[model samples]
Target chain A: MSGIRLVGVLGGMGPAATVDFYGKLVEETAATCDQGHVPVVIWGDPRVPDRSLSLLGGGEDPTPYLRRGVEALKQAGCEVLAVPCNTAHAFVPRLAEEAGLELVSIIEVTAEALAADGVRAAGVLATSGTLHAGLYANALRRYGVAAIEPDEPGQRRVMAAIGAVKSGGVRPAHRRALEEVARSLADRGAERIVTACTELVLAMDGSHVPVPVLDPARLLARRVAGMALGAALTG
Target chain B: MSGIRLVGVLGGMGPAATVDFYGKLVEETAATCDQGHVPVVIWGDPRVPDRSLSLLGGGEDPTPYLRRGVEALKQAGCEVLAVPCNTAHAFVPRLAEEAGLELVSIIEVTAEALAADGVRAAGVLATSGTLHAGLYANALRRYGVAAIEPDEPGQRRVMAAIGAVKSGGVRPAHRRALEEVARSLADRGAERIVTACTELVLAMDGSHVPVPVLDPARLLARRVAGMALGAALTG
Candidate 1:
């Protein structure tokens, strides 16, 4: 309890995305040796019911599983928590209240980053569940930043690309579909595009997009690292 | 209590190596969807006293810290455990007996793999602590395989390359040193070279070696994944 704060990750909303986030967390930390890195405990339960399907009323409730993960982390002596999945954050408010630990919000951190950079309008690329729940939109709206969502056709393509990433691997077609939707969003006055979905973050390369890309997972990783290292808290 | 076994990782011997091991775990799993992947809990405490330093009698004992990690993972409900660090295997015998959980050994898996492939003599590249502890040498000997270690000067280069991977990043000098040692070992009647140290596995590209490279971390990852997924356990 006296050393660096132990960080807990509630992961495996999809196993690959969680690994990606952990890699980013390692990369973001300023460490000169093995001892300089933060301590972390991860409860990566891939068996948690699909967050999107659950939110869309097509799958079992994932709240129980999510709660179980949080409880395990707490029992393991985690001082703070991070959930890497965007759709999973739809349940964060209640989870945070019951978790009794500081839960870093990926959505809040992404919105704050946009607001701090003077972004007035930003395009969001995420799963239908995140969009349906308005997780990013609601967070960004509070900061007076407009969240531009993909149109119905564009969103369908986004979903297809995300699915391709999860099922096997992303194909050229999936990348092209994501690129088209990103351009469409940029055409609709999106100053910057946010890859809110972890799956899209894995599938879409930022260089292919029309505008600058904001990766919420990377942002959240940095925030968590800073907190664990006892650095001044910044958005 | 009766679902898929939760795999626990006793990691953070160095953060990057642990991340590399977890990434390999994800890649080795035959998962078509999120739920298809195995559940995992990782106690990644970078503050665990340096295994190499402690083994050299130059740093604090790491046993207490290692035991603490084991207890935490147990409390978190992990069914099986894996330690990614090669040097840490020196403590595994005692830890396993007390852990009340199945601990997958990187050293044993690597040896078994070599034996299965009909490799008679294998070059082992690892930290000084691992060489000093004879973790790989003893494990290979049990399978009637000869363990070929680097000469004095070559051992120094292996250590330097490992340090380079831990401190900042691998440089050309580090890669060249590793390549030279690998060639020297191959010239000494070695059939295959084992990247026993996790850091060396990260720094050395497999294709650069003259002989086929055996990565123990990858072997352990597949074993842990199989155990969790209820697949038949194989060497």
Candidate 2:
């Protein structure tokens, strides 16, 4: 049904995260020339009701907005869709079914990646919405990878770091707070740490972490590129 | 028509340049929160026939592909448009007329910026396609800003630097070559240097240019952001 599948990005869960995902997609593609890069149709509707706020019962439903974005991308010729925000994956299955487009789940993809890498247990750093909805927890469990989350206070720190990044305060304090949480998770026997939140990926610079950090956004970019290019995926 | 205008990005003249433009748009927006950022519908079709080759009499016309992108962005509700590629602007006035979208001209924006900044003469660094079509030259002259282009050998180096960037070969040597060209232009009494080519923007780090570098893309981004936010335009 395709020559090259167009990658639809359901973005603007946060504007910066969407831009970061697009940049990573360009960087991960094995293109010798510009034409070799994947074709992307980004529906960056910043109006999408905030996912975390909804999951926390503090905001409106994001389903309708997400559905509209999916429809727009499909109309624009995207054969496969990916939402860069991890919290947004809660609506993926339903939206993917409704849109009839192959949706790439950041949670499922990351869990599969962890299982494939023989990780028995992994630490997750994400928004309270993601943890509350069991987005990563359920996926990891289904993939036979135990999900370890930071303690309540640690989770608060993660949320604060995420908030700082979204507010354009990607300072060293934000990174340090995340690193401290990652270290605490590693102390509790997490073999690897998953930066499940896109904002957290922006905050933490992948340095000085106690364990190896797994960035699902980067993985999703590689997967999207491989699928678009019809190449064996490896990252 | 009553609300803030949606920004349509006619992109993928080269994938990296599109990303750079989007990033700049996000950065330049006067946003204190995620919702404050502009809504962008990007039609990043990498398969658009090469603009430079088409302009230089070596490739198919890019008009059809550009029209499709503009149409898609319009259908997705982009009220205003901007194309990041300077070479792509050769088709802008016509496409903007046909598509009935208010397209922001990077060349015009830069020339206006130069004139506003009280600069009488400026040097241009861009692809042969842009130079040959006099995109910046004509726009600068219209604004009473004298446009100075690289001499034959210097032009060759600039073209090579652009090719290096397009092929994803952004080596230090490429940056050095472009810097040498900029320095030579400065030596010839050019007061301000206009980085008319997006690729050249990628190569030169903007740290050590002898004179001020007027980045048209950055100017375009700021303009697009200001327009979308309904703010007074200033660079």
Candidate 3:
């Protein structure tokens, strides 16, 4: 494992997010040779107890199962663990503590990256669970950056796209609605549209959008790669 | 971990192959709910040093890296590790030994499924390295089943499609050439077309061939599900 930090990803909130993170890791890493590819240990168990169910008191507490997943990764030789699912981040602190691995914080990195790029206020087009959790709001506050989200109707559309993507169906109507949500956010002063969900990143097919997209999964992938390459992890 | 067996997949020979395996896993697993979904860990480091370069003697040996990958999975809490790459199976024994996890054999599963289906003979379509290494030949010997393959020209066509897929260019020509190889193999007493490469499985699109088409990855996925579900692992 010399010069290689195995990234343990506790994923499968939906398959698309895991695929997006893996793609970004492959694309961002500067590989002189094939050997430079970052080593990622991905447990894309979408079977993970539903985040909303447990959070909303409609389902079993996800702690036992989530902890089991984290333990699975720690045993698998992952030095750092990442959860690509925006909703699943709610349980991050406990999961990290129980698993005993340094987690690559998704919310903090997104806020910092946007602020660094001089985007003081960026649009966060994410699912209702993510919006309600205030994960980004808490993180962005420190940096004096505002986290923008969709209006109620727009939120429903974003949730619809997310549901379609989670179910492994990418319908045309879904794409149009999602793009409308992005445009609406931009119209409401969003400097950039954050494709917070992994599926959104994959669903984005170079549609002509005025606002730049900040895919949080892709950003986290960069941090994970930097750790893998011994690049000081400064960012 | 008690009832489920985590399947470890060392993939990323090309991005498409890994995607194919993932889709097959989703399709084959018997999941009433998400948790019933098989617990899988995939290490899709596409930059793992090229196999041909190491095998044909240019770069360092891939065997060491392959071993490391298996170890990564073993540490990832995988009960059984499987290599989705057909050619990589050529180095399985050594890697499996180093990883100390039960390595599910792809060639064995493909052959067993064919023999069980009463396939006295079949067409084997795979990568150049898989063919050159006799991975299929040895596996088919057990059932006394004769398998036809492409002639030199047909081999060239098959190799071309495999190369095109690995490079992320999905062209009509590549699909056309693969179809031609399937036809050629059928002309030579092939009762079934064995999709040895996962990419070939998608290219074939589950459209029944003049001869029946067998998907080895799908079959392998079924076997993993069986092993995990405590159902009999048949072919």
Candidate 4:
């Protein structure tokens, strides 16, 4: 039997999202037996300073903690790396460079998926850090797709929903807030909605959205699974 | 805020079970925010040689692979360890000793839980390897709780259901088979049913069973979360 690549997940920007990504990865892989699935090593350090808080210049810089996670994954012999949090991807390039590992960019993959689907415009739902950093915007721009973002009030709703998910289970209020923001984005001519925040993916279901939903975390999981199983070429 | 301990999960005996365990851990934590949850590092090497096959002397030894996982977790700075698979507990004693980390035994925790509940006899649903190893029987015996196992035919059904879950998603057939066995065990005077196998925990829901179900994985997750969050003492 051919060997599968060991994929490392640098996670716990919030613990639930990391678990969500891992679960999706297992579901996406074409494995008949236990050994047929991809081997994974995850460093889920929830203590890593909040990515959004840091990006907004209000909290401690998460670089050192993120670097520690990358080093641990590299030491454990992971050939490829995936960071589940969209905001955390802002630091992924530097971490991948320092660790000399093939890091899968969730933003790039989502953009590529949108372009492949002939989507001209997509609404992004993510943390303030991810929106401020333009991680998804820049990637989507490169694919010739227009990235629509939430208005200030909508963004607040998005952040509130995200906070609700992170703090505990998603209540009906959180889901309703996200659905409203998604509907507003759709009314503004968004062809599809991208759940850029991992926590948002947990809160908002695709069926409840006004338009088709694109989950970056699930896309990342599928890409990582494909790479590990050798079903798709590792880029 | 006080620091939470990093718990290492040596998993992927079947990838889905590990995901289930981690998800439960996240849910069980008294976290209102991401950092309030336990930090975790998982070495999910699905490639580990089959624990059941090894115990039955029909396949390669899983010791070296398990040792590799233990060493990887130790190097990652995990202060405590948990293995999600019930069959894997057969090697937990040696691995804990070799790694010098506190390894939480799912079997022992389950027994403790049963004893605390004043359960006199409990039905166990697990893999043949775990049955052969007498992990639950011995642990439960220590707590003065009688462990009732499936008869030979029922055991075969249990193994088949586990294999079904590992191969892919659990089907209605698999759940039906397990429910039947659980019913038979209940009819035989089992006070409670212990879903000793992690995979069985995934396939069979507690409400569907004839008696109250105790999931060792959930218990393990709760125990580890408590220990990590300083809610309970680490044994």
The alpha-carbon lDDT assigned to residue A209 of candidate 1 equals: 83
Clash count, predicted structure 1 = 0
Model 1 Cα displacement at B197 (Å)? 0.8
* Candidate 3 lDDT, B42-124, residue by residue in tens: 87666576765455456566776677778877876777877777778888777787768887788899999888988888899
**Local error of candidate 2 at residue A157 (angstroms):** 1.0
Off by over 4 Å in 3: A27-34, A56-60, A93-102, A153-157, A169-180, A199-213, A230-235, B12-16, B30-33, B44-76, B93-103, B115-121, B152-183, B198-214, B226-235
Per-residue alpha-carbon lDDT of candidate 4 for residues B1-235, written as tens digits (9 for 90 to 100): 4456789999999899999999999989878888778889999999999999999889999999999999999999998999999999998779988889998999989999999999999999989999998999999999999999999999999999899889886789889989999999999989999999999888886677778999999999999998887843333
**lDDT for position A235 in model 1:** 18
The lDDT ranking, best first, is 4, 1, 2, 3
Clashing residue pairs in candidate 2, if any?
none
Candidate number with greatest DockQ: 4
Model 1 segments beyond 4 Å from truth?
A1-3, A231-235, B1-3, B231-235
Looking at model 3, the pairs that clash are: A47-B34, A75-B75, A76-B75, A76-B76
Candidate 4: stretches off by over 4 Å = A1-3, A231-235, B1-3, B231-235
TM-score of chain B of 4: 0.96
Per-residue error for B8 in candidate 1, Å, reads 0.7
Question: How high is the TM-score of chain B in model 3?
Answer: 0.91
Error of 4 at A220 (Å): 0.7
Alpha carbon lDDT of residue B29, candidate 4?
Answer: 86
Give lDDT: candidate 4, residue B9.
94
Docking class of 4: high
